[model samples]
Target: MAFSADELRVLRRALALALHPAPLPADEVRECLQLAGSVDEAIREAGRLRAFLLADLARYRTALPGSATGYLELLQDALAAGYRPQPDDLASLRSLRHLPLAAALLARCQGIAERSVRARLARSTAGPSGAAVPAAPAPRTRLTALPGGRADIKPARPAVPGKPAPADDPAKDRPVPTPAEAFPPRKRPVPPGERREAS
Candidate 1:
Protein backbone atom coordinates (compact mmCIF):
# COMPACT_ATOMS: atom_id res chain seq x y z
CA MET A 1 0.00 0.00 0.00
CA ALA A 2 3.00 2.25 -0.31
CA PHE A 3 2.25 5.11 -2.71
CA SER A 4 4.91 6.88 -4.81
CA ALA A 5 5.46 10.64 -4.51
CA ASP A 6 3.51 11.28 -7.73
CA GLU A 7 0.62 9.08 -6.55
CA LEU A 8 0.58 10.82 -3.15
CA ARG A 9 0.37 14.22 -4.84
CA VAL A 10 -2.57 13.03 -6.97
CA LEU A 11 -4.27 11.58 -3.87
CA ARG A 12 -3.83 14.85 -1.99
CA ARG A 13 -5.30 16.91 -4.86
CA ALA A 14 -8.19 14.43 -5.17
CA LEU A 15 -8.92 14.71 -1.44
CA ALA A 16 -8.88 18.51 -1.62
CA LEU A 17 -11.27 18.50 -4.57
CA ALA A 18 -13.57 16.04 -2.75
CA LEU A 19 -13.77 18.27 0.36
CA HIS A 20 -14.22 21.57 -1.51
CA PRO A 21 -16.45 20.17 -4.30
CA ALA A 22 -14.48 22.11 -6.94
CA PRO A 23 -14.52 21.27 -10.67
CA LEU A 24 -11.20 19.75 -11.76
CA PRO A 25 -9.39 20.19 -15.11
CA ALA A 26 -9.92 17.40 -17.66
CA ASP A 27 -6.33 16.12 -17.19
CA GLU A 28 -6.59 16.21 -13.40
CA VAL A 29 -9.88 14.26 -13.48
CA ARG A 30 -8.25 11.62 -15.72
CA GLU A 31 -5.22 11.41 -13.39
CA CYS A 32 -7.50 11.00 -10.33
CA LEU A 33 -9.39 8.17 -12.02
CA GLN A 34 -6.12 6.51 -12.98
CA LEU A 35 -4.91 6.82 -9.41
CA ALA A 36 -8.14 5.27 -8.10
CA GLY A 37 -7.73 2.34 -10.48
CA SER A 38 -4.15 1.85 -9.37
CA VAL A 39 -5.19 1.83 -5.72
CA ASP A 40 -7.90 -0.76 -6.43
CA GLU A 41 -5.42 -2.95 -8.31
CA ALA A 42 -2.93 -2.72 -5.47
CA ILE A 43 -5.59 -3.75 -2.94
CA ARG A 44 -6.57 -6.73 -5.11
CA GLU A 45 -2.94 -7.77 -5.55
CA ALA A 46 -2.31 -7.56 -1.80
CA GLY A 47 -5.32 -9.84 -1.16
CA ARG A 48 -4.03 -12.37 -3.67
CA LEU A 49 -0.58 -12.27 -2.12
CA ARG A 50 -2.00 -12.85 1.36
CA ALA A 51 -4.05 -15.81 0.11
CA PHE A 52 -0.99 -17.34 -1.52
CA LEU A 53 1.08 -16.88 1.63
CA LEU A 54 -1.62 -18.59 3.73
CA ALA A 55 -1.80 -21.54 1.37
CA ASP A 56 1.98 -21.88 1.40
CA LEU A 57 2.02 -21.66 5.17
CA ALA A 58 -0.55 -24.46 5.42
CA ARG A 59 1.51 -26.67 3.12
CA TYR A 60 4.67 -26.01 5.09
CA ARG A 61 2.84 -26.69 8.36
CA THR A 62 1.56 -30.04 7.10
CA ALA A 63 5.18 -31.00 6.24
CA LEU A 64 6.01 -30.51 9.97
CA PRO A 65 9.57 -30.85 11.39
CA GLY A 66 10.93 -31.80 7.96
CA SER A 67 10.01 -28.29 6.68
CA ALA A 68 10.76 -26.47 9.96
CA THR A 69 13.17 -23.95 8.44
CA GLY A 70 11.06 -23.15 5.42
CA TYR A 71 7.85 -23.17 7.50
CA LEU A 72 9.29 -20.70 10.04
CA GLU A 73 10.39 -18.36 7.31
CA LEU A 74 7.07 -18.59 5.48
CA LEU A 75 5.20 -18.13 8.79
CA GLN A 76 7.13 -14.95 9.54
CA ASP A 77 6.30 -13.59 6.10
CA ALA A 78 2.64 -14.55 6.47
CA LEU A 79 2.50 -12.83 9.89
CA ALA A 80 3.88 -9.68 8.26
CA ALA A 81 1.09 -9.97 5.69
CA GLY A 82 -1.51 -9.74 8.50
CA TYR A 83 -2.25 -13.45 8.64
CA ARG A 84 -3.65 -14.71 11.93
CA PRO A 85 -1.92 -17.86 13.21
CA GLN A 86 -4.16 -20.91 13.04
CA PRO A 87 -4.13 -23.89 15.46
CA ASP A 88 -2.18 -25.91 12.90
CA ASP A 89 0.49 -23.21 12.80
CA LEU A 90 0.77 -23.19 16.60
CA ALA A 91 1.01 -26.98 16.78
CA SER A 92 3.63 -27.07 14.00
CA LEU A 93 5.69 -24.43 15.80
CA ARG A 94 5.38 -26.30 19.10
CA SER A 95 6.67 -29.52 17.55
CA LEU A 96 9.63 -27.73 15.97
CA ARG A 97 10.42 -25.56 19.03
CA HIS A 98 13.76 -27.39 19.52
CA LEU A 99 15.12 -24.89 17.01
CA PRO A 100 15.78 -21.40 18.46
CA LEU A 101 13.91 -19.75 15.61
CA ALA A 102 11.00 -22.15 16.05
CA ALA A 103 10.95 -21.45 19.80
CA ALA A 104 10.75 -17.70 19.21
CA LEU A 105 8.06 -18.11 16.57
CA LEU A 106 6.13 -20.41 18.91
CA ALA A 107 6.15 -17.76 21.67
CA ARG A 108 5.03 -15.11 19.20
CA CYS A 109 2.29 -17.34 17.77
CA GLN A 110 1.06 -18.25 21.27
CA GLY A 111 0.70 -14.58 22.21
CA ILE A 112 -1.20 -13.88 18.97
CA ALA A 113 -3.46 -16.91 19.58
CA GLU A 114 -4.23 -15.80 23.15
CA ARG A 115 -5.09 -12.27 22.01
CA SER A 116 -7.27 -13.65 19.21
CA VAL A 117 -9.16 -15.84 21.70
CA ARG A 118 -9.72 -12.92 24.06
CA ALA A 119 -10.97 -10.77 21.19
CA ARG A 120 -13.40 -13.50 20.10
CA LEU A 121 -14.64 -13.93 23.69
CA ALA A 122 -15.15 -10.19 23.97
CA ARG A 123 -17.07 -10.14 20.68
CA SER A 124 -19.24 -13.12 21.68
CA THR A 125 -20.16 -11.51 25.00
CA ALA A 126 -21.07 -8.23 23.31
CA GLY A 127 -24.54 -7.32 22.06
CA PRO A 128 -25.44 -7.66 18.38
CA SER A 129 -24.43 -4.05 17.70
CA GLY A 130 -21.12 -4.58 19.59
CA ALA A 131 -22.22 -2.79 22.73
CA ALA A 132 -21.72 -4.56 26.08
CA VAL A 133 -24.77 -6.55 27.29
CA PRO A 134 -26.14 -5.46 30.65
CA ALA A 135 -26.40 -8.08 33.37
CA ALA A 136 -29.85 -9.50 34.21
CA PRO A 137 -31.37 -8.23 37.42
CA ALA A 138 -31.75 -10.55 40.44
CA PRO A 139 -35.11 -12.26 40.96
CA ARG A 140 -37.47 -10.84 43.56
CA THR A 141 -38.44 -12.96 46.59
CA ARG A 142 -42.15 -13.83 47.10
CA LEU A 143 -43.53 -13.62 50.61
CA THR A 144 -46.36 -15.86 51.87
CA ALA A 145 -49.70 -14.60 53.31
CA LEU A 146 -49.24 -11.48 55.43
CA PRO A 147 -51.34 -10.32 58.39
CA GLY A 148 -53.95 -8.91 55.97
CA GLY A 149 -54.09 -12.31 54.16
CA ARG A 150 -52.31 -10.95 51.12
CA ALA A 151 -49.22 -12.35 49.49
CA ASP A 152 -46.47 -9.85 48.69
CA ILE A 153 -43.45 -9.72 46.44
CA LYS A 154 -40.36 -8.49 48.23
CA PRO A 155 -37.88 -6.30 46.39
CA ALA A 156 -34.41 -7.77 45.95
CA ARG A 157 -31.76 -6.35 48.29
CA PRO A 158 -29.32 -4.01 46.64
CA ALA A 159 -25.86 -5.44 46.15
CA VAL A 160 -23.14 -4.04 48.41
CA PRO A 161 -19.83 -3.01 46.88
CA GLY A 162 -17.62 -5.38 48.92
CA LYS A 163 -20.15 -7.97 50.11
CA PRO A 164 -22.42 -10.44 48.31
CA ALA A 165 -26.18 -9.90 48.40
CA PRO A 166 -28.33 -12.12 50.69
CA ALA A 167 -29.66 -14.18 47.75
CA ASP A 168 -26.11 -14.81 46.53
CA ASP A 169 -24.93 -16.08 49.93
CA PRO A 170 -25.95 -19.77 50.40
CA ALA A 171 -25.53 -19.57 54.19
CA LYS A 172 -28.03 -16.69 54.49
CA ASP A 173 -31.10 -18.83 53.64
CA ARG A 174 -30.15 -21.80 55.87
CA PRO A 175 -31.43 -21.73 59.49
CA VAL A 176 -28.75 -22.52 62.09
CA PRO A 177 -29.70 -25.32 64.51
CA THR A 178 -29.50 -24.82 68.32
CA PRO A 179 -27.19 -27.12 70.42
CA ALA A 180 -30.19 -29.24 71.62
CA GLU A 181 -31.53 -29.69 68.05
CA ALA A 182 -28.05 -30.47 66.71
CA PHE A 183 -27.33 -33.17 69.33
CA PRO A 184 -30.42 -34.84 70.93
CA PRO A 185 -29.93 -36.73 74.25
CA ARG A 186 -29.84 -40.54 74.08
CA LYS A 187 -31.73 -42.74 76.67
CA ARG A 188 -29.73 -45.22 78.84
CA PRO A 189 -30.64 -48.95 78.27
CA VAL A 190 -31.22 -51.31 81.26
CA PRO A 191 -29.27 -54.60 81.47
CA PRO A 192 -31.01 -57.83 80.28
CA GLY A 193 -30.88 -59.41 83.75
CA GLU A 194 -32.41 -56.32 85.40
CA ARG A 195 -35.22 -56.29 82.82
CA ARG A 196 -35.97 -60.03 83.46
CA GLU A 197 -36.08 -59.47 87.32
CA ALA A 198 -38.47 -56.54 86.87
CA SER A 199 -40.75 -58.65 84.59
Candidate 2:
Protein backbone atom coordinates (compact mmCIF):
# COMPACT_ATOMS: atom_id res chain seq x y z
CA MET A 1 0.00 0.00 0.00
CA ALA A 2 2.86 2.37 0.94
CA PHE A 3 5.02 2.29 -2.20
CA SER A 4 8.68 3.45 -2.27
CA ALA A 5 9.43 6.78 -4.00
CA ASP A 6 10.98 4.99 -7.02
CA GLU A 7 8.00 2.60 -7.23
CA LEU A 8 5.56 5.53 -7.04
CA ARG A 9 7.43 7.29 -9.87
CA VAL A 10 7.36 4.14 -12.01
CA LEU A 11 3.62 3.65 -11.29
CA ARG A 12 2.93 7.28 -12.30
CA ARG A 13 4.92 6.79 -15.51
CA ALA A 14 2.93 3.58 -16.28
CA LEU A 15 -0.36 5.39 -15.69
CA ALA A 16 0.80 8.30 -17.92
CA LEU A 17 1.68 5.82 -20.68
CA ALA A 18 -1.77 4.22 -20.29
CA LEU A 19 -3.46 7.63 -20.77
CA HIS A 20 -1.12 8.60 -23.69
CA PRO A 21 -0.33 6.17 -26.51
CA ALA A 22 3.43 5.70 -26.12
CA PRO A 23 5.90 2.81 -25.68
CA LEU A 24 7.86 2.47 -22.44
CA PRO A 25 11.67 2.67 -22.34
CA ALA A 26 13.41 -0.72 -22.01
CA ASP A 27 14.62 -0.02 -18.46
CA GLU A 28 11.20 1.33 -17.38
CA VAL A 29 9.52 -1.75 -18.78
CA ARG A 30 11.90 -4.01 -16.79
CA GLU A 31 11.27 -1.98 -13.64
CA CYS A 32 7.48 -2.28 -14.12
CA LEU A 33 7.80 -6.07 -14.53
CA GLN A 34 9.83 -6.30 -11.31
CA LEU A 35 7.19 -4.20 -9.50
CA ALA A 36 4.40 -6.47 -10.76
CA GLY A 37 6.23 -9.54 -9.44
CA SER A 38 6.70 -7.87 -6.05
CA VAL A 39 2.98 -7.00 -5.92
CA ASP A 40 2.08 -10.67 -6.64
CA GLU A 41 4.40 -11.82 -3.80
CA ALA A 42 2.76 -9.28 -1.43
CA ILE A 43 -0.73 -10.60 -2.34
CA ARG A 44 0.35 -14.20 -1.64
CA GLU A 45 1.90 -13.15 1.69
CA ALA A 46 -1.34 -11.35 2.71
CA GLY A 47 -3.40 -14.50 1.97
CA ARG A 48 -0.99 -16.63 4.04
CA LEU A 49 -1.22 -14.13 6.92
CA ARG A 50 -5.07 -14.13 6.76
CA ALA A 51 -5.18 -17.93 6.93
CA PHE A 52 -2.84 -17.91 9.95
CA LEU A 53 -4.98 -15.30 11.72
CA LEU A 54 -8.21 -17.25 11.15
CA ALA A 55 -6.65 -20.44 12.49
CA ASP A 56 -5.41 -18.55 15.56
CA LEU A 57 -8.86 -16.97 16.08
CA ALA A 58 -10.47 -20.45 16.06
CA ARG A 59 -7.99 -21.65 18.68
CA TYR A 60 -8.64 -18.60 20.83
CA ARG A 61 -12.41 -19.04 20.56
CA THR A 62 -12.05 -22.62 21.78
CA ALA A 63 -10.03 -21.38 24.75
CA LEU A 64 -12.65 -18.71 25.69
CA PRO A 65 -14.33 -20.55 28.63
CA GLY A 66 -10.97 -21.21 30.33
CA SER A 67 -9.06 -18.05 29.30
CA ALA A 68 -11.40 -15.07 28.95
CA THR A 69 -8.85 -12.18 28.87
CA GLY A 70 -6.58 -13.78 26.24
CA TYR A 71 -9.56 -14.88 24.15
CA LEU A 72 -11.14 -11.38 24.25
CA GLU A 73 -7.88 -9.72 23.09
CA LEU A 74 -7.46 -12.17 20.19
CA LEU A 75 -11.18 -11.98 19.31
CA GLN A 76 -10.98 -8.17 19.13
CA ASP A 77 -8.00 -8.39 16.77
CA ALA A 78 -9.81 -11.00 14.69
CA LEU A 79 -13.00 -8.88 14.56
CA ALA A 80 -11.01 -5.79 13.56
CA ALA A 81 -9.74 -7.76 10.55
CA GLY A 82 -13.38 -8.54 9.44
CA TYR A 83 -13.70 -12.00 10.99
CA ARG A 84 -17.29 -13.26 10.78
CA PRO A 85 -18.37 -14.94 14.03
CA GLN A 86 -19.52 -18.57 13.88
CA PRO A 87 -22.31 -20.05 16.06
CA ASP A 88 -19.62 -21.39 18.36
CA ASP A 89 -18.10 -17.95 18.67
CA LEU A 90 -21.50 -16.45 19.48
CA ALA A 91 -22.10 -19.07 22.18
CA SER A 92 -18.64 -18.39 23.64
CA LEU A 93 -19.31 -14.69 23.61
CA ARG A 94 -22.69 -15.19 25.32
CA SER A 95 -21.03 -17.01 28.21
CA LEU A 96 -18.72 -14.02 28.77
CA ARG A 97 -21.61 -11.49 28.61
CA HIS A 98 -20.76 -10.34 32.19
CA LEU A 99 -17.83 -8.50 30.58
CA PRO A 100 -19.06 -5.30 28.82
CA LEU A 101 -16.69 -5.70 25.85
CA ALA A 102 -17.71 -9.34 25.22
CA ALA A 103 -21.41 -8.39 25.37
CA ALA A 104 -20.88 -5.52 22.89
CA LEU A 105 -19.01 -7.69 20.35
CA LEU A 106 -21.66 -10.41 20.76
CA ALA A 107 -24.41 -7.89 19.87
CA ARG A 108 -22.44 -6.64 16.85
CA CYS A 109 -21.69 -10.09 15.40
CA GLN A 110 -25.13 -11.61 16.26
CA GLY A 111 -27.01 -9.86 13.42
CA ILE A 112 -24.39 -10.88 10.83
CA ALA A 113 -24.36 -14.49 12.13
CA GLU A 114 -28.17 -14.69 12.03
CA ARG A 115 -28.30 -13.36 8.48
CA SER A 116 -25.70 -15.90 7.44
CA VAL A 117 -27.74 -18.70 9.01
CA ARG A 118 -30.93 -17.51 7.26
CA ALA A 119 -29.13 -17.35 3.93
CA ARG A 120 -27.90 -20.94 4.37
CA LEU A 121 -31.39 -22.12 5.29
CA ALA A 122 -32.92 -20.39 2.26
CA ARG A 123 -30.40 -22.12 -0.03
CA SER A 124 -31.00 -25.63 1.43
CA THR A 125 -34.84 -25.51 1.44
CA ALA A 126 -36.88 -26.38 -1.68
CA GLY A 127 -39.15 -23.98 -3.60
CA PRO A 128 -42.16 -22.15 -2.11
CA SER A 129 -43.81 -25.52 -1.44
CA GLY A 130 -40.80 -26.53 0.66
CA ALA A 131 -41.33 -30.14 -0.40
CA ALA A 132 -38.64 -32.44 -1.84
CA VAL A 133 -39.46 -34.49 -4.95
CA PRO A 134 -38.01 -37.95 -5.47
CA ALA A 135 -35.60 -38.42 -8.37
CA ALA A 136 -36.81 -40.51 -11.33
CA PRO A 137 -35.61 -44.10 -11.82
CA ALA A 138 -32.76 -44.69 -14.28
CA PRO A 139 -33.54 -46.01 -17.78
CA ARG A 140 -32.87 -49.65 -18.81
CA THR A 141 -29.28 -50.33 -19.85
CA ARG A 142 -28.43 -51.40 -23.43
CA LEU A 143 -26.13 -54.37 -24.09
CA THR A 144 -22.59 -53.62 -25.33
CA ALA A 145 -20.12 -55.75 -27.32
CA LEU A 146 -17.63 -57.81 -25.28
CA PRO A 147 -13.87 -57.90 -25.97
CA GLY A 148 -13.99 -61.26 -27.85
CA GLY A 149 -16.37 -60.09 -30.64
CA ARG A 150 -19.49 -61.07 -28.70
CA ALA A 151 -22.70 -59.39 -27.52
CA ASP A 152 -25.54 -60.72 -25.30
CA ILE A 153 -28.64 -59.20 -26.94
CA LYS A 154 -31.53 -61.16 -28.52
CA PRO A 155 -33.98 -59.43 -30.87
CA ALA A 156 -37.63 -60.11 -29.91
CA ARG A 157 -40.61 -59.51 -32.20
CA PRO A 158 -44.39 -60.11 -31.82
CA ALA A 159 -45.54 -63.38 -33.26
CA VAL A 160 -47.69 -63.29 -36.43
CA PRO A 161 -51.41 -64.22 -36.11
CA GLY A 162 -51.97 -68.05 -35.61
CA LYS A 163 -48.16 -68.55 -35.29
CA PRO A 164 -46.51 -70.05 -32.23
CA ALA A 165 -43.83 -68.18 -30.24
CA PRO A 166 -40.24 -69.27 -30.62
CA ALA A 167 -38.91 -71.71 -27.99
CA ASP A 168 -36.73 -70.21 -25.24
CA ASP A 169 -33.06 -71.23 -25.15
CA PRO A 170 -30.17 -69.98 -22.90
CA ALA A 171 -27.80 -69.79 -25.93
CA LYS A 172 -30.48 -67.73 -27.77
CA ASP A 173 -29.78 -64.85 -25.32
CA ARG A 174 -26.54 -64.30 -27.28
CA PRO A 175 -27.38 -64.68 -31.02
CA VAL A 176 -24.48 -66.27 -32.95
CA PRO A 177 -24.94 -66.27 -36.75
CA THR A 178 -23.06 -68.65 -39.11
CA PRO A 179 -20.14 -67.29 -41.22
CA ALA A 180 -22.36 -67.36 -44.36
CA GLU A 181 -25.03 -65.35 -42.60
CA ALA A 182 -22.43 -62.83 -41.38
CA PHE A 183 -20.71 -62.38 -44.80
CA PRO A 184 -21.44 -64.32 -48.10
CA PRO A 185 -18.52 -64.96 -50.47
CA ARG A 186 -17.93 -62.40 -53.26
CA LYS A 187 -17.51 -63.44 -56.98
CA ARG A 188 -14.20 -62.66 -58.68
CA PRO A 189 -14.10 -60.43 -61.78
CA VAL A 190 -13.24 -62.17 -65.16
CA PRO A 191 -10.50 -60.91 -67.54
CA PRO A 192 -11.68 -58.94 -70.65
CA GLY A 193 -10.49 -61.68 -73.13
CA GLU A 194 -11.41 -64.74 -70.99
CA ARG A 195 -14.54 -66.85 -71.66
CA ARG A 196 -16.89 -67.92 -68.84
CA GLU A 197 -16.96 -71.62 -67.81
CA ALA A 198 -20.37 -73.46 -67.64
CA SER A 199 -21.48 -74.74 -64.23
lDDT of 2 by residue, 9-42 (tens): 8888888888996877899999989888888998
Task: Please list the residue runs of candidate 2 whose C-alpha ends up more than 4 Å from where it truly belongs after superposition.
Answer: 114-199
Q: Please, what is the whole-model Cα lDDT of each candidate in the order they appear?
A: 0.86, 0.80
Clashes of each: 0, 0
TM-score of each: 0.66, 0.54
Candidate 1 per-residue C-alpha lDDT over 103-179 given as tens digits, one digit per residue, 9 for 90 to 100: 99889989998999999888888988988775785578886676864345455688889996666345668998899
How well does candidate 2 match the true structure in TM-score terms? 0.54
